[model samples]
Target: MDYKSYPVVENIFGISGLNANLANILMITVCSAIVLLIGVLSARAIQMKPTGMQNVFEWLIDFVKGIINNTMDWKTGERFLGLGLTIFLYILIANLSKLPFVITTEPGHVVWWKAPTDDPLITLTLAAIIIVLTHFYGIKIKGFGGYGKDYFKPVPFLFPLKVIEEFANTLTLGMRLFGNIYAKGILMALLVSLGVSGFFGFFAAALPTIAWQAFSLFIGAIQAFIFLMLTMVYMAHKVADDH
Candidate 1:
């Protein structure tokens, strides 16, 4: 479906002078809250014999930890793990929130909340934060000179290109995430509007939408991993003075 045409949940506040973007912010805040609640509750209720939810949550944490450990030195990884873990959880939930079943009612209101990550501003803001934090961590770990040396690697003449690359890379990372999730929403809208028989809609349309949602879920997970993984790798290379 044409993404430009999807009904966006707009200015829900109905306030005369409120920030229009407030709708998006509110959505993100809510999603963050949910992720936080789930994470804390999962952590607080310890279990010798794990339930399925606990197992799944723990498995995800371990998976993220493994990424950190594999991509970075123990000292740096330990320092960033708390922040990185939070990034993964927030992005995952934000992307997954785009899938169907996030229903809403009331005239002039579409979904009160779209996926937080679907917004360009939000995604890029996150990308900016990740990049800034990575650089900050690099400076903290290896002093300012080490971080500076990374840009002029192999040849001092390469500094300008490297600087451009850094900005472009983060920009791509943010936009890639926003594009994929937003496209999925448009695709599901297409499935729902294909003008097929009700049974065909259920079996043919709904079925694939389910599969796509599941696939999108996987995509969301991978994107989150890739974003944080790159951050770690960027820092690793920065701190590795020889590079």
Candidate 2:
């Protein structure tokens, strides 16, 4: 398939020629709703002996808590448990959103469904949000003067490098996720195309496609964990005095 044939729904507004990716907007909304629904359903009933959704939810909470404890003292990290869990769930769902199937429209082959993380814009936006929140918490926990002075700590010359590091962190965090998900998306698309080619091609691609999907699910979970870990690490750097 020609890459140029990939359809994107965009609308230009105002004289600046700015456009919005309608497909990404839709997918983000859907993913957010799914995450919210899970949270609601999982917490609807509380029991001493957890089962089903509650058990899964408790496991996830414990996992996030472990990540926070590893990065910073629990006293400081306890506040971010909700943030960490939400990020993990949202990203995991977004990463796996396109795995079950691919949807495209005829006449133009416009992609109608895909993982939100497959787009650099979405991933980068997430990175920016996390980075900004770190700054917010840093200033909140440490006074503005203290937060500003951390850049020049130990020596004054490191300030420039510290400034640059923030930008690097955001770029790397976002690109790392986008690269992994986008590559997976491309390979899945290829396998799907092969499966549709003919009977022989379908048979040849079926097993590999299924196997790749299972691996993709693992990759998606790992990526979510990595993202959550890094977020807490960065948060600790900002909010913890020992860092």
Candidate 3:
């Protein structure tokens, strides 16, 4: 991949040499719009007896509720239902976006479209946001003093380790998603290149491409669920008194 071929805006917002990846930005916008559309269409009309999208939407709600229940009390987790649902849906869509096809420009072979989650910057930003929100809720649910005290619970010697753990959590959470999606992208690209090499190469690549694509769908869903579950788990640790 020619990394330099990416459509980037340098010196963004007048900051010297700050850069923004247009491809990632575009993919994020597209994924968010799809999620929003799903929300609107699914909930457009309430029925005396739910069917179709309503059923799917309600099922998703229950799924997220179960996740929250597993991590923390429903009373505490109920307020986060929307947050959890949105995250789950958005990540799910983003992960699956590039499975069907990848678009690239000629000559430089610049990627015009792909899963946003495959990008480290996007994944790390999401992880950072979640971590920040966990801290926010921790302070809101427990007083600042209470939350702060948990960092030193049982002993004061572990404070530095706990601090380091927060950073570790952020890195692992982000890189886990990025690594999986990015690897899948790389494998798919290699398969495509092989198919285009010659007739014999095409036959050799076809079966593996199909198999990988099928497996990738399952991998995408699992990754999304893992991300959601971990988010709640982290949140539980931050807000729960027993943690």
Candidate 4:
């Protein structure tokens, strides 16, 4: 089995989980805990005019809030602000982790705890969560009847098509993030196989890899934004009508 093709799963309290991939619930749990702890501690990093980590998180919160406001009505978008911000930071850090030094030579060729986004399962799971959230909120805002009527869309006769589109959109959302991030891993694997410095690798080989890493970071953020936007869009659509 190509280690690359298979999840880096490790047994954890009975369940086999991803070893190097973020699919490992344990790893994600740890990461999430760290983020939460930091967020809690830094909630008031700066009282007057925040500095350091507090400043960064505040700016991030403001940034996510702005995105929500611009893309969705204030009333509708407020609910998703935390999710959007969490997704952005979780994914941003995950992607950026790839740019740093990696340990490599681990059980599953692990390195630098590579960004969670680099793992498709993680992205797909997140996509599923987003879809679920959209539906949950959709049903919450609109009654069960309204949620069901959403499938019929513009007209009752369009039920089948509407259902297909809704299903397709959710799958596509996951696939979009998965495909790009997974591709990054593939590229990195190829480069590492060449036994050279990475673009950011202190060694000379890093020259080329750095450019790719930068591009990956850009892609990561864009994907995160798109995912959040789609979440809001889906929610808005669901709540907008009862067919």
lDDT (Cα atoms) of all candidates against the true structure: 0.74, 0.88, 0.88, 0.67
My TM-score estimates for the predictions, one after another, are 0.83, 0.92, 0.92, 0.77
lDDT of 4 at 122: 76
Instruction: Give the poorly placed runs of model 2, Cα more than 4 Å off.
Output: 1-16
Error of 2 at 9 (Å): 7.3
Candidate 1 per-residue lDDT, tens place, 151-203, comes to 77789999999889879978987898888888877776777555244666557
lDDT of 4 by residue, 1-243 (tens): 233333443333433663343334544765677668767877845677788888878888888888777666777778777888777767655655554334344466444355566556777787778778777888898789878876765688988787788678778887887787777777765555443433444354466566776787788778777877776677667665421
Which segments of candidate 3 are over 4 A away from where they belong? 1-16
**lDDT, residue 221, model 4:** 77
| Model 1 misplaced stretches (Cα beyond 4 Å) | 1-9, 12-18, 47-55, 101-111, 195-204
Candidates, ranked, lDDT: 2, 3, 1, 4
Instruction: Give the candidates in order of TM-score, highest first.
Output: 2, 3, 1, 4
Each model's backbone clash number: 0, 0, 0, 10
Clashes of 1: 0
What is the per-residue lDDT of model 3 for residues 1-243, given as tens digits with 9 covering 90 to 100?
A: 333344422221324787677678788999999999999999999797999999999999999999999999988889899999999999999999975456766655656688999889899999999999999999999989999998897899999999999999999999999999989988887787788778998899999999999999998999999999999999999888764
Each candidate: RMSD: 3.6, 2.4, 3.2, 4.8
What residue runs in model 4 are displaced by over 4 Å at the alpha carbon?
1-23, 99-112, 197-204, 241-243
